[model samples]
Target: MSTSPHILLITPPLTQLNTPYPATAYIKGFLGGRGYTVTQADLGLELVLKLFSKEGLRRVFAEIEAGPYQLSDNARRMLRLKQSYLNTVEPVIRFLQNKDNTLASRICHSRFLPEASRFDNVADLETAFGTMGLSDQARHLATLYLEDLADLIKETVGPQFGFSRYAEKLAMSATTFDALHEALQAAPNLLDQMLLELADALMAKVQPDVVGFSVPFPGNLYGALRLAGRIKQISPATKTLMGGGYPNTELRTIQEPRFFDYIDFLTLDDGEGPWLRLLEAISCQLPVASCQNEQLADVVQNNLATGNRQLATHQLQRTFLRNALGEVEYHNSPQPDIPHAEVGTPDYSDLPLTEYLSVIEVLNPMHRLWSDGRWNKLTVAHGCYWKRCSFCDVTLDYISRYETAPSTLLVDRIEQIIAQTGQTGFHFVDEAAPPLALRDLAIELLKRRVTITWWGNIRFEKTFTPDLCRLLAASGCIAVSGGLEVASDRLLALMEKGVTIAQVARVTDGFTQAGIMVHAYLMYGFPTETAQETVDSLEVVRQLFAAGIVQSGYWHRFSMTAHSPVGKNPAKYQVAPVGPEPGPFAWNDLWHEDPTGTDHEAFGPGLAKALYNYLHGVALQEPLSFWFDFKTPRATVPRHLIQQALQEPGKPDAARPNNRLFWLGNTPELRYEAGKKGQQAVLTFFEQAEDFEVKVPAPLGPWLQTLLTSLASDYDTKVLLKDAAQSFPTAGGQKWEQFLLSAGWLTLREKGLLVL
Candidate 1:
């Protein structure tokens, strides 16, 4: 070896239970090829388990016994309520209770925490942190949820320190840890001792040149900073770098240089470029500023300030990043392509990869999806094309950062994996696999006759025709996942989602016809969504399912992410500001609301349950292919029976809530194998398809009528409407009203429609 100096790459645990998968592997590949010995540590997960380890638990229990900051019975009750998800996240709960990290169970606990209620308000967070006595950094970090902790680190530390480099997301994970923290009190000194012990172990064994900490989420922030401090205490000479999501977004406002005492460098933007540059500078004994120069600093500043807007709309003003000397900077070059192939096979040997958590061996959503066989995960592309969906975070990394790997390169990677693992199935982990790349990939797979099964995310566009879908299916493609954010056309337009509802229906039908499974992403509670509009969304879901288009769906409450288009331009989507106390990721939904005080009830539990029922097949009027594919049971009498049960001129609400067709077999106690309790439980029909069926959800019937009527009202002069001159009377009045409502012509006040 040339003694060229080695670097360690670390992915801080975004969630307590998640491991660093793609991040460590990809970074190892890039740096290892460049003569840098890179070591990655998933300290986030380690710390999470440490919290519940025997030692960890002893410390926590001791603290509770001592009663730090007056944590009374009420506080304990609240904490217990938060941790009520113990049954679901048993591994993590037990691990936390143990509070020891040396054990294998602790390590396993790092990969799976039960997800539940997120922090709601700044006060709620203040109370949480207050109970724990967290320092300022930890307090600030509590704002982010577990899923995004890594990215938050990148945003906060990287930008705050002024290291203006960008790298692609080497990893993608969806694990969250807040639910586990619900029952625990933050004990800073106890956590510090555990981290010190872990750090000492690393120094004794690995003797790594530099130890990097990946604190990607807010929940992990206190733990990350504490761990970073402990690492330094153990090995003073070993350099420490903090990167990931936290530093990327919040770095701009964090002015305290004291935070840098433990962290030598903070990587901003994408870690791949900046991290490599920082390593070179450190190894070569060059001034850190020389790596960024001045021009690049300016561009980095502007880019960080404006995010994707700088890349998409205003790059012409400064095409090349410039420094103080007016020299162009290339350190941050190749600003992450969303559709690129692996530069090389991820170096997983160094990581405790096999030792990390595996969901497949057990039963989970991922396992259920792969019940036929196990499959490896791979990314065909990165970034997104239709990043224009206002709800997306295209701006944070810069929109237009679209890139696709060559078909040859992708195939090579797949072949190498198949050969190595003796597995033929792969998961394409792209944000939205570009249409052209998908087509090219299909063509190449066919040409090479690579008999590998795969599935990935893609945009719901017209380009995915029946023939194309068929070709993909023939080429071992199994499922298609894409976001259909809202069912209302007006809301869709407001979000700048280019695809139309009709097009979505057609494309979904095409995928279904081609035997491709589809899992749609649905969002409720956008800024402009009125009570009727929200209801109308359910109607659209009902139609999509009844039409045999959608196979299944993942419904989410709409969130204005810090870097997404909608988050940046809230006014465009009618989002008004709530009081400005930052809380948790879930609080993003609370930012927007109706100021007129007319439709807040639309956001209540009823609509949420109604939509949940529909998505889970509890409210289905007809059995779609998705229900059978998921092996979900029908719970109540079929639609025909329900219709028969409905007496003429009678309302359905008169029936008992749980006795309704949708809730027949579904009880509060039911849970999914994924440990996703209420969220994942499906409404099953007991025996015959006719024994349980759902009605056309209340939202759709009304919204459809509104949309049509609004269309007629808007274009009345252009079309000859016989009813425009007088009171419109006909059997289709309700249909017209549904269309009109969805079309945005009538309001609740004007139509005098009762709120559901």
Candidate 2:
């Protein structure tokens, strides 16, 4: 065997159907750039593609028929239409992938697809699809058809089958590994069998010396372990490693030796450092096949220490391995994590891009963006710039360790990703994309003339001025989602959100005014929040929707996690951590008694119903009590709170000397014409679909023309507003500030001029 081991990275099944999660792609890019052989795959998409094909449905039908389980009317109806399903499944798959658009009309009109239980309760077709094109309409129907089959699988052979998650219940806040371990020990279910088959085939093909699974969610934990177990059975020499969002938060204090029976190493926090160290430890003098868990720990502890000074004392940065004594041992190396800039562009090379299913499970515009199409996932920065939100896992490395790359470097990666994937869409998966970083990124994208459509998360800071929002939109930002968590000002301050209801209203209104979609993440439960506060928060959300400030929103029931501020010191928030008690395997989410809050659980259904109606443009005029079955406190918030907030005039711009000026519209054509007093300069500007003219005296015209031209130049120019003002011509004794209020200047400002 080669002295250097090849790496195979994978994203576990059922995280997403519309896009490949970026974890494996990121690792593959970083590791492969270091000249380490790396191959990556999205096993979820592969398993999905395999299970939903014509032949796959034949197998599914036959398997269900062979089984001895009671079938629901839906399942029975689907089974009866098995032939029709088998005939249309492949075509439906093709059409959903945008490979066969010709089938959309037939699917919509010809009864080409079998109607099943999933279609039984679909909302009015006209209301849902009236504005959507034919293709989108058909895609939603195909999505439901798949859901119908998914229901059959879950109800019969695979109770764990879900489009977005697998065995999630077993892993959600699973403090103990007993249930997960027991489930793993059982015989493979149908879905598990399919996953194993994919993994086995992959291992046989790659024969990699190391296999790493990126488990980004609780749903992925079981899938990762299940496949890692199979990898061990196939090749004990193949080192199995697991790390990601799940372990980063859940398995920090892992003490279960049984967990190591599945994977050789479990890494916490950022994986890049730990994986590099772990590899050095594994590539020891011991023969690869002979290096079992105990011997591997020995190699990590004894051999690697002598070989590498950074790994002295057998340290592996933030990693856990089973020791020779049949116990789990955590190891750490002092080596810092690989810097964000140094980690190369995420490689989407080995992933089956076109094969990913773009399923539409939701009808709301902003919500459907998650499931509608592929978006090249990128990061604006390494971590959250504002990591002070009490409810957030701000203490975790992913949030706490903030870092940013240069704007040019970020755009360089963007171009590289677009070139590779042939996709111009991006989703910056940052904790909260820093506002200043996004500004620079947007400017860089414009300067480089990189055309792309993108969106990401951000904090509702006042820095997102209307002008700045327009600047972002000009650079192709389509939508942004941010936390409007606990809209009550008191609770917001308690959570350290650094924003109030009025501030969110202004910022979201700014984004909306700039023609960008805004989605708000709202929270219901918080310490010291009363029922009246809950009602008021709902009222605020309702007005936000009614006033068209926030286009979409989601209300989350607050769950305290161990890494968050509140979870760490519950007493400070006037809450008690009534926990299952931290156990050996998984422990992050802490059950807390928010003694001062209302019955949070009781509001979940009403909140969901109200939000659902609001999303669909329904029931906004109904009383807040209409959503809740029980009597609720009357709204303390005013009827037009958001309207009044929106009506409030924005503060005048402060033209700081260093503030940059640029033109986002097309270059203007300057000409001279007759004026009342003298020759007038007329600058004709062309926007996307319209053209307008700005007139000024000839002398002032040339000066303004030159400034606008320089600002709009293809090169990345730094024409500060102060610099432009200082260079103003003394035409008719018009002051620089006076000229700013002129119709010509105002028109230019309205037509895409940005002073940011």
Candidate 3:
């Protein structure tokens, strides 16, 4: 090989406005670790920055005025205020990038930012934010202001224009490649031209031998192919590839030869194995047939027949390539996927870490985390530990194959990421972060003094005790989200979610009590879900919100997918598949008619309305029927169900002796204070917000002070509960067990003492 092929990874337009999607960073890190020259770009962020600039607004206004198109009242209003938008666009963008903070009060005023139809939601804006945060309120207003320009663009130049997605409708549920192919074949629109120009400029600069597009969402699919087409035309020698969330699930059964015209290679599941093997083939400059031997094909066929994925690691993993005969060929290697520990820390070097815009679409505390700030995205582990959820694509490799890295390695990675990004906010993009691993990682972060604010998804398992939640919060975990899908116990059991409504209530309450906000992923319209069950589910959610157990939540409509258990065995769930039949391209997201379930479409709006009110702490006391126009069954759930569950005391600290004993507060300073017994020993804890002191007689105080020192997170040795109990010093015949019930111990417990 002349030289190891220079690889370029691009995150296509568009995904998030706040943070760069972790897919490319992850791939770049692993590949860079392997001694490859890998550079990366976030075209999504680039496009947003370009499209929202002063010059960009001028072009948009020009296009709208010149085009022969009918304008909505809002579009006309924005057109009338064109100069206002042009003047404020650049400053507003800079402000959103966190480069300007003095403009918040001005934007909060009536006339600072240009207003259009998007400003009509003034009532909801005021209600949602009140006067709590001046900057955040300004951000919300600026978001709407930008959205007004987006509306004008959609009406005049680019019909598919969106803040987070472009031409997404063409790719969503696109069972065939015809629509996407046709769009790519058509002349580029103003937006598409801008995307291509940006891609072309990057390609010219990098001049890479291979261009890899990370198509994480359906919206990204079109842009990836469009960019690939441009790269093929301008630099014919360069190879192209596609991977990430979209192809990992949707394009597994691809049979379209036209699809390969844009991308030479496409990978599924984790990219580590397939990418290494593909690079080997590219180094040899050989075709697909020359690369994959006959025995490898035999192994793939054999594995498929037997439903076995664990095989020899020498072959190319799940990949799609076009052969010399112009036919599609699929190759799945027998080798095991890379271990999670070996994937290396996600590198954010090539990405513009500071240029991303932090747009605020939602105002609530837990909800705004998604779109309001940059988060260093990392995965605690690979795959879901519990992959039995019927509605999920449990059969997919991304979920079925489970692996974990040690907490020490995870903390090392976390520290490395913080050093690279200079941002301490992390979003653990795990399917479900293991509780024990999080518990250990929390301890490691505390031990190393690596402070970061983080959040992640998890199953509401009973293992997340109040003490564990406290440990996580101390480690800077500000929020957590878990699926409380279809709150009916029967539906939960049917879906194999392994969590009941009562368990969710208890878990969410533990997080809330520990000062960590919780967001529940609510689901509706599970197979065989009756009207009564649906109404009852709403009641459970209401109770969760009313009791202040859950701070934020969302309702999701269930869609059976081809890889899910329900799609595989619809008879089991009593649902029938409605046919569009599998086409020559995309194949996930199966259409189904749940004959045994209620009219799910009818309940969607009502469920959404009720949730919208619940999110803002409004209309919570209203009757269930008040949310819907149609007569609905009364909720059968008891009013106190959630409260009762929250009140249920879990196992006490005395029951778990093997658990680690930790001191999160400051180290105590020992001194003598005047007392009845001449001079008693007093220990003072100088905490950040407040300071407190405890006094005890003579030897007991000195011994307790030494124990607290050893229990501090900075200490190397761990002190177990049983060992700590055994070492307790008795005073006035106060035994070890008696000391546990004393005010001194309880006060210490309240002041950051943790038995985890």
Candidate 4:
């Protein structure tokens, strides 16, 4: 190896539209600490920028001419619209909330939209500019609009809208390829041409010695491969390394050696330690046997089995580490062969710190839940705990366990980060937020008076006793997000969520009492969920609200992820494959084909409105305080209309009703309906309304009718929310219902229906 060869670190793009922690920064921080000259380039954000460029568009458009590009206008429009829609952040979030497998499957297919990408060999400038496809004027217009908007943004927001060197590379690996594919199909090989142009700019403007690409998402696997192929072709001398989520997760399954031919080398695990070692070897012209081919096979096998395994401590030490407070351990440590105490703190000097600030509009979204009012994303602690969750891909990239540093070590890392970057807040990007680690963290933070704000994911456990929660809050813990999965005890048992409804209620209450905001990560559409169970889950949530135990919430449908426990063992979960497999689940339909699948109706069925209503905090507007408020008419609303207003946005005000015409028409006495006493419940609610007529928009009548129809359909049988076609909005069913009730349009006593 040439003495002191220049090394380039790249971070693949991620889902974050704003700035995200770069892979290279972690590596570069490690390498730089070891006295190596490392430069970072984020290709992910660059890909997004390319989407806005004329040169990028023209090249892809031209390429379409050389291919079999027959597609319907609707499909093309869908493609273009999806691309544009991706510019915003909501679609991705909304997509994640949907549970319909049929819709998800169609979306998965559409990810390979036009199917033209496979035809172009290298997917390079020549291929991109030579393909044959229809003239996509709409795609062109979109490109122009985005570009103009980007320009205005740059001018108004300065570099804040751009990506850091590390963030750029991350985006390139994470999102660019997909974005390119969408653009290319709509036009031509715009993705390739854009890369070529960017390569030139980098070569001319930055003149870096090496170029690495981080490939994080499996959806981006193909595009990343093609982009790497093109980059290698353009600059033969520039070293190309492939790392990130793909290699880390797929290390074991990499049967094709040809991938090695395209990229010079592959890095895995945390990459920081290995990366630092490689840089040192290169800098000193040392023959490093560790990174050689003979050892690669073993590395691959171990990584694949471990799935997102963490780096060894010896590996960590080879890079850099600093600051220590407590001991660290790995739960399911992948590299037991490695030590932890020896690893050094990562170096941050080699990264382009300024670039990250441009795109950071606000701190990470989760930070908003914290009372400390600080912004932070995650650092280290990458994978999840309980990787074996039925629906989770535990055996996938970065989901495996790593050696966790002691609380002292964590504090040290945070202190170092604060000194170097002045980032005082943090978001521990963990899967389960293990109780032991939290206990240790609280001890350390309290001891050191870290004076920083933080938040993270946690499982609902009795360990979150009132005392522990109170201590956590005092130690700068602002909020905790728990994946309650489902509210039904039976469903919870089936999914192995480990927490009971009672436990959930208690834990949530504990957090709330401690004054920490609670954001619940709920899942509906579990394979065996029945209609009654779905409604029961809603009731549970209502109970939680009544108890004043939860502050905020988010929900998702159960998805069978690739390599996940459930995905691997579908039958164990009573989930039979009723349709084709779904694409990689993204908050948005990143790789989806039919944005709206043909079988979309089948996915929502009868539960769509209910699901939607539940998420928006309106399902059964009875807050945990509902009991106390019920007596005073403070927590009630016209429950029927809540579902209607949510689905039909800005519904014509014409639906305004004649409040005087409607009333709680009552018969002599309340009567219970068989075992359930359903009729009596209605009578009690009507009596509470005190002859008040509920006024709702005329358009909502249909929604009420549909809800009643679904309820009747379920009658005595347990109908899972998954089986229903419609989901209700939380805002509509909960908040709006409360509004009407509080407005005295509905009452609790008249029908004996109001439980509160």
Candidate 5:
């Protein structure tokens, strides 16, 4: 018998996207390093793609027709135009998948495809009617077509049906296991049927000794449990396990036996340590089970009888396992927490790279980052550096703990990832990447001559100086998103955000000046936030856009969570608990009420509408009260607050140039050299800067090289050619300069060639 366990890592249904979530990738990499034969399957993306195919649509329409539920007008129309849908479904999917650009013109044509209720919005029509709008229209129509089918599935098959989430209604804020258990026992929907088929296919292909389900969100919970139950039913010998963000947060106090009926073990926090120990325990018992032809329970009992008390202990540190009596046993691994460097590079080899759909439901350019392209997700650190936010789950391990690998290690990982995945785009999925760590990483990336476009979340703090921002942009940073939540200094202080409005404006302005796009994560309705404060916060947000400091932003209403400081001590913030605490099954998003009696819920729609208009540059001068339907007290915020903050304290210097250069093209010619014997690489380049020519070892040299190579070029080629004679040293120099100028190596500036 093979001593090595065959582990199959599964991403459950409804979390489909252009790229797989990083959970399985991280787990796969960690386990693979330990010499385990691991395979991963993204049943989520597969299920959605399958359901949207021509044959799948036909089955859906047939199901809708045969079902007893009342059909919406859109559903009736889809049934009527079933033939057109069937004919266009695959082609539409191909177009959306970026497989066939030729289908775009066909799909854009109004008569080529059927439309439904999702196209009823006037904004969607406007987008469809805009210049070269056909592709956009086609994508929207395709999304609508899928949504119509999803609705049909939801109405007739399962009420919880969605493309990215299934049975979420039964999972979110589920205080008891009864709802989820009842959901599992209920009739299978179209989604459930498709997931079961996928589960069976995966099990047959891998024939694994262990199956691990990664449940990242509440929506993925039901599908994960359902899949695990099916796996246990068909292959009773397989050891089933569950872990991920949802389980780490929700299943902490697991009193429910029904959960164990599906999976034998539930690991928490970082899965690396617990998983290793669990595998070792299983491997030790496997031989006994094989010899006696006994079930896993007997083997477990035999191990316990033989004084394997460590594995038999119910209160183990990080792992919750099942014992001989079918009772859940919690065990803490004796192993220390794995270092960040040892987690290994996230392996994306098992995922279907090309088949994932890049859906574009919203035409907003900034929001497109979530769905537009595949980004290799990586973490700068193990957890958050600042887990002090009152509304945050600061007590949780994922937030409370903070550890980071060296900058050299980070770049090494990046290089490895690039070689493995053949992709240069990365998304840092950190809770909040520390500013100092980012600075060091940026310098290291430049020193090693590594090049990649990346973006991530950060805290809008004063550490991000203008010079630092410029350095980051020089190192291929395109965009940055950070929390500017609540935008009011008083509430910001109360929330312990550690940054004021004035500070945020300056920091964001620095990023904007450095040619990087800025996206702000705004919040409203924090405990004790007044109506006037809410109005004033919108003013700050508007001024941020008006000053062109922030390009994109989103606002979310705050909800208290159990692990937050506010939840633990509600009266300190003058808020009282409104509902009973969440029970054993799931416990995030607790209800609370402010004694101040501010109707925070009423401001949501207006704030969203105002933001929508603000993002599109439609309403800048509109009154804060104008967004709200009812009479709202005029915003008391000073109109010139942002403008005043932007003005520097000292007088402008006549000798120093105020203007900074910007890169024009999407790509530039540059090379990074790694110096020998622990020395930094020497960098050489040309562009607009204080110095035009220089050679030095990194970290400073590479930054200058990147900056010089990225200067803006928007002038006519003929003009640059004509001016080359005056700028060059000789006739031959002029000719060479002209060639370089024409090739975008140089550009004409009023002062001189802007290079350093």
Candidate 6:
């Protein structure tokens, strides 16, 4: 057997999909590179799949019948259809898994699958989108079927149940350790029972020396701790560690002694460096002095003075360790941050890929991307390139410090991922992909001849030119989504987004023209945003859709985060901090009251309703005041603002060169040949640009070559055409010019310009 200690990395319950979150994969890749044995599990997806099964539903119904809990009307109705649900749950699951095509016909034809009050609006959705095909309808209905079962579990077992988040409300905005402690101490719910049973099987299988739990969200906290608590109870000698987004953010200032009872160590920031140091300490390779921080050394000396003999010899830097006195002590690490290029490609070899279920929750076009298919999640960089947004977590290292790997290395990692997972789709989970980096990546991908579909987040800035968008599309970019937060020029400038509404319209239009789908991340209710601004923002959104620059968008209410610029200086934004002021457990999303006195809260429903209708191509001509129920001021925005902005005026007599030939992977060639029928004119257009070649009039061939060469020289069309007038006869030049204009050989920038 290898001497290296076994490590088991786990993802807790309630993160969406069967795919493991990228955190475990990152740590696993790093540790594997360091020559240690690592095993990983995605318990979140496993538990969800296990619970939604026919047998699981049977057990759930039995628990519901046996328990003393009160049932909601929906839960009571589900009990009445218990037998039908038990019969159909397995088929629905198999259909979702793509294992049974025969069941699709049946599912589409009959109402055999049970529905719930949660799905009472399915009819409304169908009516709104028009009658979709049976496959889509079945998928929607099947989603509702699973949701109905989930609802029964929620109403009877745990009130905080959700497909992706369980007991989230209990953890959200939790200020003190006492709330989490009491929640952990509460009687186990049905979901908890299922998680414990799953954990029991996994622990028995892996039997790891060190079990690390990855808690990426507040909702995952309760589940992770509960699992750790069970591991401590069953196997007291096994060391338990917790780290990820939640602990990295919330547990940084933790002082709770009870929190360390189940977990021996809690790491912060990027887990790779700390994990290696921890393993070294555990293996007795790290010297005592090297492993110790001043605070931790003081705790250790104090414990020794108290005559404690059970203290472990292991010590860790950059981690919270438990001493003999049962107190958690933080140790600072002297290690420098690891370069992102050296972190290695995320490994997914240990995850079960085929078992993941693709869930469809909403019929909305924009919402389906979340649950539609499996996407390989990779980060293009370590942090945001533009971290100056006032509402963002600019103080956090994950956002503040931007670092990126070389384009060649990124493509190499992409190839490695394709070889490992046999999947060619990717989702770059970056805060905002830097434009220069994306351009370099697109070029490298083309040079390497790598074919993979990908999309990611970006800032709506001018760097994404029409040429760059087309190049990206040629390199297999299918869609892009970016923040267009608060859509008011004044608020945008205040937020330091670095892009105005006009710039956003132009950028989105570029993407659209390149045949890439566009989705906007919209925000409302920023500090000092009056009712008039909100209405005007909606007006701009309406024009963006009407002009067909953006196909989809989402509206989120502005939130104050602890690490944001606004949070650091509240008075700057004319807001005062409210209660739940930074405590030990959670330090995110600080509540604040805006002195501007606008009811930002009430704007959410109307904005959402209006955007929803806009997405479905409805009510575009309605007045801005139609969305809001309460009397709102009329929008002061000019109706033609977005249209004029999107129709950007070009320099007089200027022609923007189309890079389509470059994207097609070849150069154009023209040939003139005399035929046997008495010097007949023939022009042959041949190259590897596409699969086919075309023949044009011979008279047009020389003019086309001249235009292409002129475009390469970057000369304006007026200047080039004036030069061309001296070379060809008037009649021949006119015919060739008409052909070039009509055949898309020459593009004029001024004809379609919209004037406001």
Residue 390, model 6: lDDT of 98
In TM-score terms, candidate 1 sits at 0.57
Tens-place lDDT digits, model 1, residues 158-204: 21110111221211111222432331224434444555576677667
Model 1 misses residue 704 by how many Å?
Answer: 48
- Model 6 ranges with Cα > 4 A deviation: 123-132, 285-317, 650-661, 665-669, 673-756
Better of 4 and 6 by TM-score: 6
Best by TM-score: 2
Candidate 3 lDDT, tens digit per residue, 1-756? 135778999999889988999998998999899888899999888988888998887877887788888988888888888889889999999889899978888998769898887778664556667777778888888888888888888888988878777778888878888888888899998888888889889988999988899988888988889899999999998989899999988899888999999998889999988888777656545222222334455654555466564323345578888877899888986877889999998999988877887787765577689898999999998999999999999999889989999999998998898888889999999999999999889988888888899999999998898888999999999999999999999999999999888898888988999999999999999999999999999999999999998988899999999999999999999999996698878988888998889999899999989998897899999999999999999999999999898778777777888988888887799998777766677889999999998766656787888889877735568789899878777553567767677777888888888887
Instruction: Please give the RMSD to the true structure for each candidate, in Å.
Output: 19.8, 3.2, 5.0, 21.3, 9.3, 6.2
lDDT string for model 2 (363-482, tens) is 878878899899999998898999999999999899999999999999999999999999999999998998889889998988888999999999999989888999999899999999
The lDDT for every candidate, in the order shown, is: 0.49, 0.86, 0.86, 0.47, 0.76, 0.76
lDDT of candidate 6 over 184-225, digit per residue (tens): 888877778888999999889989878999988988888888
TM-score of each: 0.57, 0.96, 0.94, 0.54, 0.84, 0.87
For candidate 5, write residues 190-251 as lDDT tens digits: 77888899889889989999999899888899889989989988999898988998888777
Q: Clashes per prediction?
A: 94, 0, 4, 132, 16, 0
Model 2 regions lying over 4 Å from their true place: 285-313, 654-658
Candidate 5's C-alpha runs over 4 A off are 122-138, 288-316, 324-327, 649-685, 688-756
Among residues 3 or more apart in sequence or in different chains, the pairs in candidate 3 whose N, CA or C atoms overlap within 3 Å are: 311-334, 312-334, 312-335, 313-335
Cα displacement (Å) at residue 503, model 1: 1.8
Model 1 collision count: 94
